[model samples]
Target: MRTTETSSWMKQLTSSSRQGRHGHALHLFFTRLCLQPSIHGLVDPYPAAVPTALRACAHLANAASGRLIHALVLTRPALASDEVVATALLDMYAKCGIISSARKVFEEMHVRDLVVWNALLAGYARHGLPEHALVLAVKMRGLGLNPDRVTWNAAVSGFAMAGNDRMASDLVCAMQDDGFQPDVVTWTSLVSGSVLNFRYGRARMLFRQMVAGRAHVMPSSATVSSILPAFAGVSDIKHGKEVHGYAVVAGVEQEVTVSSALVDMYAKSGLVHEALRLFDKMSERSTVTWNSMIFGLANSGHCPEAVSLFDRMLREGVKPDHLTFTALLTACSYGGMVEIGKTLYRAMREECGIEPRLEHYACMVHLLGRAGKLDEAHDFIKAMPVEPDCFVWGALLGACRSHGNVELAELAASHVRTIEPSNAASYLLLSGALASAGKQNEVFKIKRSVKRRRVKRLDGCSWLETS
Candidate 1:
């Protein structure tokens, strides 16, 4: 019943969609094909066409278009009952953040495959419903459906995401016992999960074990990138350099993610020169790459270098983002470029179209406060469109302490305490401010208050490398 032209169009669209070219052109083509009247009058779209359009909707996160496709499928019972079409619909809804709709589609499916189950499981994990995903995994096993690598990876990742690294590790072991060896994907999930749960030391150890245990399965660029943060956290330049060496030998140094992680690791480890060198040598750079280099330079006290790099990034036609502005503003704050900071703050909205986020406002507060503009900073906080957070107040308090402004310090400390009652930083800063101002009585009162709240100060520890 299909015309040759209609069949050709569907074939081309399906090919393009499979090749991951699911953009506006594909969306428009599909829409036109479905609406076009054929010799028989209303030509029902090919069953393959439905899944392709659904894929485009998933890629674009276009729920409205997906709903239209769903309606079309509903009118054609064959397409609705088709497993592939049903799976695509489920995936589209899941990706669009409509999990309830995806579940309904799954429940109504005439027959389900492993692919469909995995899709639903991944959807649950992606939406932060790890417990639901785990429960579903149990049900899958109860039906005698053995989990594949993808399923095991999802379960491990889900548990990891839930901050249960212990359970995640246990699951990994269980997966190995079930005759499924932990691959690079499995280890990567564990490493990233450990890092996310603040088990940096464990992440480092796992990275080591992964290299030693899995000789055949070499670490991917993602695996290398995941472990770099652990090195950065502890300033382990020795371990970081070793990872860098492996990245170079593995020919993944050109990968934007791996390169960026290497740059960030070196920069945070107090090797700004090395970080800059790596940044310069990168053949390709992403927005994240630029942000990392700029942030590194700014945080490492190379304020002038950071600003210079920002200018070059602009000259190279790389669009600046919020993080870009944050680094630039932070550099201005540290370097006492108050006028420049003010100009950039205004340009954030007017020029770059980036609305100031809380981090940007915090940096601005720090900028003004560091320049001894206590009154101006206070007025600025009061005039902010968004409510000032504890970081803003803490910045003001730090400035008050530096300038010996007892009254302003007290006001800032009160706001800090109200926002974060048990914040040791607030108590310590307030106590320091009062002590500096010779208010012995107030200092003693703060100490007693801290003790009464049982707020223990976190220890100040620094990473030291021995030659």
Candidate 2:
């Protein structure tokens, strides 16, 4: 016996909730629904209303509001018994970062399904409890619940997060053996995991397999974005262009993430012009998009272009973040535009209100040091609001080496050793400075120190893929 007016209001609430408005706004709408007085006073919401309200709570990450919805559902047996509502409640709690509460709800559910189990598994994975997630996956199998693609994806991601790439790859094999084909989500998880663990070679191999349609699934935009770093790592411009061609054919070139990755790949691979062309063609750009282009231009020695693009970004009303200023300062430092760097440093605080971070300070120190202003660089380090890191001291030492200032080099090297005792770079730089100044005694002392400390120098390696 629903009144037409009440039914209309319910429909409007449901529609509005599903319209994908902001979480807070949806939460307010749900709150209004709870407060609305019906003929019998504050009426119980419809069972269908529970999921939408719970979603709002999840979006806002508001556990308090979620608890209220839980209480409301408890009073209505129909809503309480609804599996969809129960699953939504479980997901909401999990997403709100209340894994224990999510587990409690999962345990209380009378009708647990694979979706419910996956939700809990993803909760553990998301909360950095990959071990717990894997154990639960085993228990889930023991209970005769078959793992689906989503389930395996979560498990793969969990292992990846745990830095167990071997186990992650084994799981993919097991997934294939279980008559389940890995989808884009599956490959993306593995690819990103490999990247995180610094196994870029294996990541590129995986990307190639995905592109060859091993699983009979096309690579998604995320898949393309994830593999760009591998090409950048090896500077494999050939493979990068191949991927770029695929993106164009797939019509995903306009996607912000893919475009950003393309720009970064081209820039890192020493093709600044190609990167610029792609940046210019982008119809829409995010802050990251601008940062990537500016960083690429700067990194590739086009400092003037980087500075000009920063100006254009400002003119277009796009806000520059800390990374933007860091890139801009880096370009000025490398180009010997000392005055421009100083001006931008001041404007970062006064105009943009961004507090100078350690990276920004490091760039400034490097800039002044590279320009042979040893005393100014030293003063800048002393004037730092935050403590100067090894990078600042190292910059000063390198500059001293260049300027043949043995005394200042010794001082900078001492500070650097104090900050990072085992770092071979500091000793090597000091040795170079002493050797250049014909101080054979100091150079011998540095060599003895290196031998005594057993400091191993990290080897530099580059990769090139051949067809």
Candidate 3:
């Protein structure tokens, strides 16, 4: 049922998906292979490309496309029964957030290998079902199939990411008892999970141990990216630079993930010049890399440059996501480019089809509010398709305080209270606006309410250098 062009598409897909790229670039490249070819009869399926195509779809989270490939694969007796194709199909289903389909595929497999078991185990681990991963591990052992390093690593990564440090450590001990010492992958998983869960201190300790040869594992490119965020979050340029040095020695400084994280680190830490220097030298740029540079520029008050860089990103044919829009909108808001912000908000939804998320909405409100358009911002919130969260209300409240709109400030603060009742921020904003308006009685009332509610303001962090 395949035409010559379709066959060529599969061949190209087979070759292209093997390239060291992930996300939208790979997704767009393989989308051509997913065109539904007519299969009303015995279809001669391209088994070689089928697995690669499915893997690429998984990376894109394109389940619909994967299902179409599945349909095509099912049409061929050879592909339907091939273990490699079946494993790829199952892996695709699992990663595409279709766990039920993945399980069904596993059940139907006449012979499930360690790879099949690990695929299913990893699916459960990565998808917030660490318990399922453990249970499946036990099930694997019961079936006389002991889990390998990959299996244990997947389980460990899942629990670590779920913020269950005790269980993840227990698994590591269990793995050692089973005569499989943790590898670089295992350490990287732990580091990544710690960073993601906001345990930066712990992440740093682990990375130190990793590099000290405790596990005899050198930090890979993944380990570099994972550890960069831990340093970035704390503005620890000293440590970030050390990691950067390691990356250079490791020959992964130009690797996209490492490069993106480095750019993000320097940018977030207020070293835009260093970040820009690295950004320009990268041979390949992912969306994260571009977003980081734009954000760095915007935050450093180079608003026009941020917008210009975003335009360049579009010119380079890179797909922009919601974060991209948020950075651009933030630049517009900070620079008082109200019209440009509105134009971008419209273009995001219309041209890019990125539905304005809560952050996007907050950015737009911030833009309008900072421009002294309080009534318009209030109207925009009322018109939002989805209910605004605390950030959205807080944006309006902060703007109200800055622009001295006590009445609208009261409304925004009340919404913030309803959303995050314990947060002292909204009440403080309302009090500030009332104080600015010479309404001492109103400010006193807010202070009394805060005391009555026993709302505690968290200690604020400063980005000032400790050195």
Q: Pick the candidate with the highest lDDT.
A: 3
Better of 1 and 2 by lDDT: 1
Question: What global local distance difference test value does model 3 have?
Answer: 0.90
The digit string of per-residue lDDT tens for model 3 on 235-310 reads 5788889999999999999999999999999999888999999999999999988999999999999999999999
For candidate 2, write residues 336-402 as lDDT tens digits.
Answer: 8999999999999999999999889889988998899889989999999888889889988988988
Query: How do the residues 1-467 of candidate 1 rate in per-residue lDDT, one tens digit apiece?
Result: 34887677777787788776788535656666657776455447767777888989999888988998898788777887899999999999988889999999999997888899988998887677888888988899999898888988888888886778888888888888888988988888888888877788888888888888654568999999998888884557778889899999999988889999998888887788998899999998878888888888888898888889988998999999999999899999999999989998999999999999989988999999999999999999999999899999999999999999999999999999999988999999989989998999989999999999998789888766553
Model 1 worst lDDT window (10 residues): 34-43
lDDT of 2 at 168: 83
Superposing every Cα of model 3 onto the true structure, what RMSD results?
A: 3.0
Give the clashing pairs for model 2.
Answer: none
Top TM-score prediction, candidate number: 3
Residue 426, candidate 1: alpha-carbon lDDT? 91
Per-candidate TM-scores read 0.87, 0.81, 0.92
In model 3, the worst 10-residue window by lDDT is: 20-29
Flag regions of model 2 displaced more than 4 Å: 1-113, 126-128, 462-467
Clash count, candidate 1: 0
- Name the candidate, 1 or 3, with the larger lDDT value: 3
